[model samples]
Target chain A: MPNAFSRIEDLETTVVILSELAAAHEAEKALLARVACCRYSDAATFAIKLALEEGMNNAIKHGNKFDADKTVELVYDISEDRAIITITDQGCGFNPSAVPDPTVDENLEKPTGRGVMLMHAYMDEVAYNATGNQVRMVKRNT
Target chain B: MESSGDLVLDVRQQGSAIIVRLVGAVGMTEATLLGRQLDELVQQPGAVVVLDIEHLDFICSSGLGALINAQAKARPYEGQVRLARPCPLVMRLLETTRLTNLFDVYASVDEAVAG
Candidate 1:
């Protein structure tokens, strides 16, 4: 999918906060509440919640390198059909392609590097900007 | 030790196995605490760690990472981290990550402790 914010123009709710896990968690709670309010199934809510957590962790830890001074931006929209979320960090982005496949035999035991992979697995669509700092994920209600 | 939010870890010893009952969700913030707790438990010789996750409602990649870290730490001492009583969501996560074979999963706390 295209990384076009215009496509989700109706998703005007934007939240910008510090690069901290606590803050990101608050944002996640609020977004998940909206997903629930949209009447998504239990499984769909779980999937969205999981994907959101992984995306936020990547933005805060990998993208911003846990820089307290930096901030993470979250833009989201929830409807009966789908939930779309975009997370952007304020640090130099890395290459998403460079991340190893965590599902592989040798990498399965690795502790980290599974955030992006899980986001893709759970979400219907996952796309990153050219800089790889910003990620947009979508989950269909079905 | 219990965290302020999301996750609570209740650690107790059952025979040779150290059982950590995970209650609530384990997200990025809780994973650090989980990792530290597991690290300490696996220090014992031939430590067998059983994670009771019946009350665990949510877990993300970071939480899974903590479990993997514990398993890796336990391997050196011939220790192991086994999972027991995982909810459906957590089980789906394990299956999706293809980690079912990586960790021994039991149907109950008693079975895991005995195994």
Candidate 2:
């Protein structure tokens, strides 16, 4: 599984704003799918799609706590070698370190934390903003 | 082909076991509903829950969480959750999450229900 994402230069970025409604998830997925279809293989597309779903879900369900008044900020970008997705929620952030390891024996059956694990597994880089309300993931073309 | 927005969970009972046929995509949005359905079925004493994913095209980690939660909840009732015939994408997800070893997976629902 890949770990942290570092700042990089040279990119094509697009900004998107979505409501806190669950309906916004489909739009996010569709945008990701379009990017995947243009630049990635079938396997890569699946991984990216899964990562996007997990990240957006965390933002909507966990970060924003399903508060309809809030909004989700998404910055979608693609470089020559990788795709960068940054999602931010307008709620009190959480510490990613506090999340339990889902792979461990005691946590295997637990429902939580698996989404974060999958995001790390599929994306080459996963990073959180200081407050933890924002997550930036990068998937390498390779 | 089932679209991502459409998630159809068809549940049926055979003997003491319950079979859930999952179709389309199971993402975070649909996870709560799916979890609730699983919760209702697993509440029965000694219920064997079999998830038939032959038609399931996609499932996120949140969706996987629902399944694991059901498995945990059913354990106290002498019940178990089994997965049957997951598509390639779903199988890869299970492997990535290291959940493949946690549940008894069968090639078909019949084998899962029989066990």
Candidate 3:
């Protein structure tokens, strides 16, 4: 824990429901409006929204595991020419790099593995920090 | 602000193509589920399919990927996928990825079904 969190226009919100279905939709609306209001083109807004939804959904389902008591903190911020999204889960984290490559051969047939791939594709940068429980993603501010 | 997911899929005997009418947020979960259904449809002759998304609420890359994957699967059989009635969100996704040109998008399910 740091003494002070800086550089993030952070709004800490929690999703504590077990349904795990509408998490992305809820977060995406706010992100989309923010992106659109920032004078971003419709395409850029959609791309960022898509990427953020995937990241949040993963945080809730895999990172939080539908535990109602647990919370997923969503942070939205912008600096210079970049839009940043950070989602932190309170559950146990895993090896982010260990996930199989969905674009490679022998894995396309798998159905449940493309979320991270889509996040990487839509966002400018996708990286996991603090042992994979914290995902920090950015999309170019257009 | 409003989200709904009531999909009505009407199948037309178009020698090959099947049109799926989407009526909700075509997000990751539904996209994953649709992948299975579209997977089964691609095995048929000609392998072409059309998606009517006029009533679509939202679509992320996951949903877009499902559509692209369905199209790719159909291509081996000389079949293709078409789009119809893309809502604002759907259109945004397409235009963002520059996929609007990849598939033939129509304005209505009838057009897609007839195509």
Assess candidate 3 and give its lDDT: 0.68
Question: For residues A1-142, what per-residue lDDT tens digits would candidate 3 score against the true structure?
Answer: 2533543435333433342656655666766676666787665676676777777777777888878777777777754366878878877887866778755546544445467766777788888886788888888875
Candidate 2: docking tier: medium
| Model 2 ranges off by over 4 Å | A1-21, A78-81, B1-4
**Standalone chain B TM-score for every prediction:** 0.96, 0.92, 0.80
Collision pairs in model 3: B83-B106
Q: What's the distance in Å from true for residue B38, model 2?
A: 1.0
Give me the chain B TM-score of candidate 1.
0.96
Against the reference, the lDDT scores of all candidates come to: 0.88, 0.80, 0.68
Residues A1-142, model 1: lDDT tens digits:
5656576685668999998888998998899888878999888888899989998898898889889889999999888888989999988898888989988889998866788888888899999999888898889988
Compute fnat per model. 0.81, 0.81, 0.16
Ranking by TM-score: 1, 2, 3
What is each candidate's DockQ, to 2 decimals? 0.82, 0.69, 0.24
Candidate 1 C-alpha lDDT tens digits along B20-115:
999999899988888888888987779999999999999888888888888888888899899999999889889889899799999999999998
Where does the lowest 10-residue lDDT sum fall in candidate 3 chain A? Answer: A10-19
